[model samples]
Target: MGRSIYCVVTAAGSGTRLGHNEPKALVNLAGKPILHHALCGLEPLGDLAGVAITAPANYLETFTQIAREAALSYPWTVLPGGSSRQKSVYEGLKGLLSFEPGNGQLPANDPTAIVLIHDAARALTPIAQFERVCQAVESGCPAVVPATELIDTVREVKGDTFTRQGLKITPAGSTPDRSRLRCVQTPQGFAGDIIFAAHDRAREESICEGEAVDDAVLVATLGHEQYFVPGSMRALKITYPLDLKLATWLAENPDRD
Candidate 1:
């Protein structure tokens, strides 16, 4: 039998960096909310066991409404998220525990079950990347993440210099080999039990809320290696105002691929 897979979209981030008054997920990409585009990518995965979305406490209703409007066939629910991204993902995983499986209910330890944790801010992530991650998980990889090779020279910085704008400029301390570097992207896939245990262990160790940048990082802390798959440029994370503009262009030009 094929494995059961679930997805958790973490959409609770405040858009402070994006300079928006609303949550990043609620910002529009095309004519719809960024969360809408994120969900749309997952819609093609017809066999998804279930879905969970973590939204800001105050915006749960708004996010719920958007999910309902998407009219997905899979069972989905929105939960109140925590103060930080890591905590929000943990909350999403906690909500997934209640998901009803096809066999009846999810077992306490289902090694065959897989889960994908995605960032709602990456509104343009391709559906193919989602499939690639799932295929890797099904092929026996416990942890998988999509990544893109870096095209620019990346340098490590040391001493800081000040600008009139108060922005500190740090001189390059050293340049790492770009061939060994990759810019990672989301919809990181993992074995359901493994991720649940990782999160539990993180809590027991009192890991700070935002310390781990991604779930894969937490899993790596548990000593598991993550396999990487090719990620599309269209999957760029929308952060600054320019990112929003780029995402908007991609949204309007779906045929560019």
Candidate 2:
């Protein structure tokens, strides 16, 4: 029997970059909200043990309505989010703990239970990508994330100064080998106990808001190695206006993938 799997969708981001007054997850993509698309993508994983969505406190009702309409098979609820993404995720993890059977923490006898932390903005992440992350965790890898190779040249710059003479270029920067760099994506998978412990430690340390880039970074900070698997380009996060438009186009034309 497979261990139980739970998901926490971080949908509390303000869509300032997307130029929307509402939360990014509430923004519509091809008639349905982005959160709807995100939840639908998780359906292929079979019935989840629990699903928690962290959204703005003010819009909890709105998110609740959306989740109800999505009609997912598993149990789910909307949670009030915190000021920062890191805090929001922390809250989501806590919410999951409340739902887990027994002491609201990982059961020592069953360490195979897994948790997937995903970004709601990445509405189009393929079901296959979710499966890959889950498989890696079930295979005994404590931490796993999906990533794609960077095709662009990356440079490390020390400093830059501007001058009236057509902006002087500084030679203090050097190009790093792009071959070793991989652009990471979510849903990042982790053993239930591992993520719970990581979040608990971060809170106790009062880690600055947004200090860790992603859940994987927090896990890595605890000195755990993260395994990587290939991710789909279609899983791109919806941020800028152009990205929203492109995602809409992609949704309308499924044959393109």
Candidate 3:
């Protein structure tokens, strides 16, 4: 009676900061393209119930080529992304509608089907993380996001320079506790209806709910049940050109491989 799980891979960015003319997802992270590594995490998931790709409309061919090279023979849709990250996500959601409900689209029976949304930059999303999210989905939670603990010292900047701007101790006059707060990461999973509704609310209200570029934060504000599952530091997002160096190193390393 439960809805099936689907994964959405968002890769629709122009690598402006990477200083490359190519799409950010297509930038080679190692022997393969960055998005290739991203989808590798989902490779072992039995080819996924449905797969959605959001990339630059101009470079959909490039994404298709990468998908071919990756040997992904799953039922997938390539949707042209939007101008902003949110817009791109919406575009991916709309594209998923083309499929037959669980094949990737929204099912009438499983309105609350689990929809795992992940950024196509984090190539190393561990299988354990994906497994945990599926478990969370089974618990009937509205959303489940991977998050890591903050063991490092926390700081709150007050001014332009550390000299001009001394630490502001979170207005409590002492270092704020991070024992509870978590630094969330992607591969965030959610119920399809709940997630779509949350984003739809934001679109209707025209308000910024969360600062993070990820979408789960926007859903969390809706007062629905949201849980955090264990995450891996190995799941790194390829941002700069140098990040690919680290990705390659990890991929090539005998231990990491």
Candidate 4:
């Protein structure tokens, strides 16, 4: 049996990049919405205790209605998210822990075992990959994160600001190796109690971690070791307008058994 799993899907972004008034997750990805594909993929993971979805504050109810029509087959609640993506993640996590008293600061007796944090934009999350996150947590790591190996040559540019079109950077020597790097993805699972504590410490210590990729980065600073699960390209996130075409392509050619 799988642990008591709570999948938190973050869908708070306005579809500015996707070029729509609808939330990115609500945008059509075939016959269904991007969020529908995500929830479809997530349904196989144990008894989906609950799903905490974050959406734009104004459209929270709109997304909630969309979720209902998707027939997601799980208990879900829509949470109004924050200004930034990381802040949105924190808000979703808080909603998951709403089941706990005092807002996620309780002890082991009332533990929520494993929590899976995913993105609604990444509609292509595969069952096999999600299984990998659960399997990794079974070994007792305080946190478990999924990362696909990087295969590109990345560079670091120095100076106060970047002259490049969109890439941003910090001071010297802050860039990580492309070879050694793993492009992180979500539903990164964690020991619920520990991850909650980790986020708590992060809030206390004023650590920004710069929206590293997923929640696991913030958890890492809270003195927890993250175990990596091999990831797949099928789980790519649909963040840009071009990604919509890719999602349509994926939908047309699913490898579903």
Candidate 5:
């Protein structure tokens, strides 16, 4: 039998940066809501078991309605998001754990189940990116993330300081080897039990908000090695107005990438 795949979509961002009155997921991209585009990206996954979406507490119904409009063939559940992204993901995982597996039986705690954690802001993510991450996870990677190589020079800041002219400046503490670095993106795939244990450990240890960078980081704390697949520019996260403009253009030119 094929492994059961579950998706957890995090859509709790307020989108104040986008200048939208609604949550980030509800912001429109092209002719559809960002959340709608995100959900549609999963359409090509044939073995998907279900999707659990975490939305703003007040906009749970709106998110559910949008998910329904997406009309995916798999079962879905919409739940209230938590205060922080880490907490929100934990909530979504818990919701998935309680999902009914459709045989009038409780879902099994299948350690082999594949779980995908995605972001609604990355509404333009392509189906190929999803497939790549899943393939990596299925090939015995406990955790997998899609990442793009960095193109710009990177510097580490020491702190605020002053030059000889007394002009305030922040000195470069060190220069990281840009060749070894990569910018990470989502739809991060993981074995279900590894992800669940990572979240549970974080909650029990009261991991600080700043410490939990992403699901991969949480899993790393448990000593699990992570793997990465090539990512696409089409997966650009829509955060600022300029990003939305660029995404609109990309959506219009779907064949370009």
Candidate 6:
């Protein structure tokens, strides 16, 4: 068997773009909530040890009920998330590490254990991608994130300042080679101890404004090299209403792309 895997799925986003009253995770996708679809994506990981889900403080019960409805075969918990995604993921990591085994005690912390950090908004991620990430981590990749090359022409803008009309004035600067750039996606996998330490370091240092950085960035700051695996277009993050419409169509046609 490969390394045992744990998951911390962040679902506290208020889907203002989805224009829904509920949190993004609670929005309907196909026949179930977006969070349900995300959990289902992890079902293919044969060594999934446990899962921790973080949701809006007021919606903990609703999230728990949805998770139960998913009928997951592995141990899982739903808890209140922090104000930001990074904080929420840290909370999830703590919650997952504290999970009680069948013997009623916290399992010993295994440095080599694998942890996957995923977003509930990426509900359409294929199941095989989860296993691919875990396998990469198990194969000795300290940090692994699924990424895809950017196809469209990219441009850099300089002189970032608000215009008199309240529109940010970003004049076009230069075009960077698209071949060197990639759009990253999650369930980012990492060695358990490494990722946990990285998060703890991030918390202690109070890096950046509002902790807007992702786990991969945190790991990079810690000087750990990260490996990239092939990401799927199906793993699109549902952000705006148009994205949701596309996701709805993709849900109906899972075999495409």
Best candidate per lDDT, number? 1
Q: After superposing candidate 6, which stretches have Cα over 4 Å from the reference?
A: 101-109, 161-169
Candidate 1 lDDT, tens digit per residue, 1-257? 26787888999988889899999999978899999999888888846887889999999999999999999777889999888888988888888877767664453237788889999998889889999999998899989999999999987878765678978776658899999999999999998888988888998897655568889999887898999999999999999999999999999999794
Model 3 clashing-pair count: 0
**Backbone collision tally, model 1:** 0
- Residue 198 displacement in candidate 3 (angstroms): 1.0
Q: Ten residues in a row with the worst lDDT in model 3?
A: 101-110
- Candidate 3: list runs displaced more than 4 Å: 1-3, 102-109, 161-174, 209-212
**Which prediction has more favorable TM-score, 1 or 6?**
1
RMSD per model, one decimal: 2.0, 3.1, 3.8, 4.5, 2.9, 2.5
Per-model CA lDDT versus the true structure: 0.87, 0.85, 0.74, 0.76, 0.86, 0.85
In angstroms, how far off is 169's CA in candidate 3?
16
Cα distance off (Å), candidate 5, residue 135: 1.2
TM-score: the better of candidates 2 and 6: 6
lDDT of 3 by residue, 201-253 (tens): 77788747323367876886688767889887777777886776777788777
Error of 6 at 235 (Å): 0.4
Best by TM-score: 1
Which clashing pairs does model 3 show? Answer: none
Deviation in angstroms for 199 in model 5?
Answer: 0.3
**Residue 250's lDDT in candidate 3:** 81
Superposed on all Cα atoms, model 4 deviates from the true structure by an RMSD in Å of 4.5
| Cα lDDT tens digits for candidate 4, 50-74 | 7788988988778888788878776
lDDT of each residue in 121-208, candidate 6, tens digit only: 9999998788788888889998999999998998887888567897776876999989899999998999888888888888888875
Runs off by more than 4 Å, candidate 4: 99-112, 160-177, 209-213
Candidate 2 has an lDDT of 0.85
The TM-score obtained by model 6 is: 0.92
